[model samples]
Target: MAASRTIEDIINSDTDNEGDFEGFSSESDISVCSDLSDNDSESESEVDQPRNDEWTKRFTPITVNDFTCESGTKLPDSFDVNSASPLDYFWLLFSMELFVEIARNTNRYAKWRMDQTGTVDPYWTETTPNEIRAFIGMEIIMGINQLPDTMMYWSKNPLIGNAGIQDIMTANRYQKVRQYFHVSDREKEPARGHRDYDRLYKVRPILDHVTVSFLLNYNVGRELAVDEAMIRYSGKLSFRQYMPAKPIKRGIKVWMACDSNSSYLSRFQVYLGRSAVGVEHGLGFNVVSGLTNNIHGTYRHVYFDNFFTSIPLLEHLYENGLYGCGTVRVNRRGFPTELKKPKEIKNRGESMVMQKGDSNLIATVWKDKRLVHHLSTLNQPDDIQPAQRRVGPTVLQLQQPASVKSYNKYMGGVDQHDQLRMNYTVGRNSKKWWRYLFWFLVNCSIVNAFIMYKETSKRPRNKKRYTHIDFRIELAQGLISGYTGRKRKASEIDCIPLVDSQNVSGHINGKLSGPKGRCRYHLKTLGVRRETVYGCTVCRVHLCRDGCHARFHNL
Candidate 1:
């Protein structure tokens, strides 16, 4: 057999897990989740085991191999990661062609607005792909060098100003690009009651484009996790969720699949309220199935939380080539009464396990600080792994199912992606709701691209790795490489890439632009430093003209 398979052929799925493949007329998209789990069947259960009021605890561990799945990352049949650049990796999820569409639609919107209101001087000019690219680059830079306000990047206040962004494109031009940005024609939008209407219609192009790219670009690992990610939005919308327990209390919910080890996002679906959320099949079941559609028979371990776990779902996964394990709710249907008893495991670290009447599924109830219930097709009920926990400044040793350990290890993929994105977020407060999603996708592009770079990187082992900030700065530089939106600054005439605080090399300049700052050479040479108005024009580091300027640039 080949070492890897083309993603599509990897599954070679004859039919969906639910039923025979019935080709639908609507695009898996058309501004929606790509899935084939739609079944009109009244029940999602294959066979609901008879309710057993009587319970018996089993101590013997299940040594079942009937439900084992393929392990490890599903390497692609062939990918050119060794020769790919950051921009090349980035194009996997987003591209200049997409930006060209944006530019065209923005001009259309600008014209529409101009015609609606009798305006004399419309400052809007048709933006080019490179200008749009520069705009995105500026956004990336701003994400890294965050100030109190967006205008600070263009401010004359030397204390907190960035000439690099201003040199690429004027702040007015950047704001104008943002102002008129459009992903789809407003005139072509379907009405609310129209069957073809999509709530995500405004940004459908990006949503569809990037969603496809995520799957097309990278092959995922064996341990993939599906979870919901919140994009913080306090704006009023029909489908916005408010889970008080989540760190982001209110925002749009997005279902995502990420590699357990790398946290590389492979698929994402924006929630569109009850209309898009299914009722016939369980929400958890539909969500897991839909997200993992392209990898059905690949035998990867899928980890999730209580929200998406159910007995029928695990059974369904077992029947297919996949395996599943997650912390499940006690109330969810399918756990035999044996595993649900509150006092089944009386002591901390003690656990009770039960198999569903010779079936492969095993439900484990372990008591720690409190009882933790887990359902798995991957691990036997009594397969335990020793772990340690701290309580009141004391570390206590305890035993847990290997599945619980796996769940803890693999379930943070989405969270990891979230952490990477939040560190340097782009975008400002906008009245337009779609801009948030757009910014989100841009951030995702950088993150996924960086991950791809790392995975496919051919750099020597001794070479220093690119930190997220370094990657963003270089990415911004590459994006603005061909920008001609504004006239070049005198300092920018022969300047190196505009790096934040980390200058590569540049000459000393003989002029002052704004307020004074600490002299670079004085800090290093004199063991004491003082602020001076004069600085190097290229690198923009302030230095004393008399003594520090020559010494600093020379070094």
Candidate 2:
């Protein structure tokens, strides 16, 4: 009786549909669309359809809801594997296997590049795992703080007030990493004649690995969103997009799906111009379906913008047991003609709601400064909620439709992801376009790792939490201390050996005789020194030639 009473109470409750029809069937519903049709003989009048077909023709409107999905084995859940060690966040997200693969690819390409250019350095004879880790650490350091105008400046000067990156690493080491950073091994696995057909061949190895790790390591919440992200790049690439609305108007465009609350990028696809040809449905529909393919039948509510929202897309989602909510453009197919019509300003907060027959599809239009339209499969026509609105100088309670409120709440997930990515972005301007994607993946990994730490940490309220800035600093220090393995800097290799002069026997034995003074022999090998008491220029200190002088001038 309680269930019946609950249903009866919902039925008897006041709704936004103007008046409740006691005799109307719940199935007799109509979706707001540009195109109007019926399985029965109910032809909509011309007024109900869009004024023009040009806009509607742009999108191949899917009219049927015949979508079906095959069930697959569920993924293993991720646990708090990084609780014991903070560095575990880095290791967990970027596994050692993955890092080794990256290192091999990068080393292979660097050797090949060096061979081609005929430029060789002994330090770069063979790239080691420790140096690779130090390379990554330097990158994290750059992200956590401002970078100098030139790479050499980071080592030459005390840019950080008391210390520089040179304190831990020589500038040349950092420069080598930046110069020869490669993501794919072009020699072992030729990108040409591949199934991907050189679309993302440049960085496909890193991309595939990182994407798999990201999806497998994190579990998404009930709400998700699909959106586009622009990687700031001004290059002569065929796939470059020019979106004026985006902060980086000219750059590469990526289609991404992320968790609604945490903004964790679950899956992503890079737009490859005319090469993007396999999608049977429109781009928007295909993107939504492909991104959510893994989570189909999970009933997660996916939200997106008007660019990706349509009746067919929402219908496809509903059919697959996933819910969708988004802002609907008037020109999109299946948009209600009533919501698109021009209305005079009657009041500050006037609104209207419409629903499809026999279906739960609902559309709401609210007017504040202008008409706002939304479409959803998970909301009711009469669900109204109040929110705080600022009027003049005072805040006041205002009624908002549930669909509009829900869309506003969930639609910014991708935007939030973009903001966090750009805040401490590891990406730097590069000649290769794929570098943009590589850094984008790294940024995503770092962001997802931070999210994981927040979710798993059980610290008390007063305990300090690691912010994004703190995360980068900690990760940088951790990578340096844990992985670099080098206990001292490369500069120590320049330390001078004694010439064994008769008068400087005490200094030769590594002991100071009197007040500290610079040794002429040490200055040539070590560049500059001010510690030990050695013979000054007045005493004519012997400067070594073979080990220190020869190497210095040659270098």
How many clashes in each structure?
0, 17
Candidate RMSDs in Å, in order, are 12.8, 11.6
What is the C-alpha lDDT profile of model 2 across 1-555, one tens digit per residue?
011123223324432232322321224223454444552333453334433221221112122222233111122356444343446765655665655666777788888887888987677645666667666776767776656554644543444431445555555665667777776776756455766567687787667666666655666777788999999889898889999876789998899988888887778889876544576557888878878766655556889988888888887877766788988888887777766864642565667776653354666778766788888877766778887778799887677788888988988878998888888868557899888888888788888777776666554444465677877777777767744334564455333344443223133322222245554556765776544433322233433333332332234
- Clash count, predicted structure 2: 17
lDDT tens digits, residues 312-339, model 1? 7886776665789999999886566666
Off by over 4 Å in 2: 1-83, 114-123, 150-153, 159-164, 189-196, 274-281, 342-345, 459-463, 482-555
| Top candidate (lDDT) | 1
Q: How well does candidate 1 score on lDDT at residue 506?
A: 47
Index of the highest-TM-score prediction: 1
Give the residue spans of candidate 1 off by over 4 A.
Answer: 1-83, 276-278, 460-463, 488-555
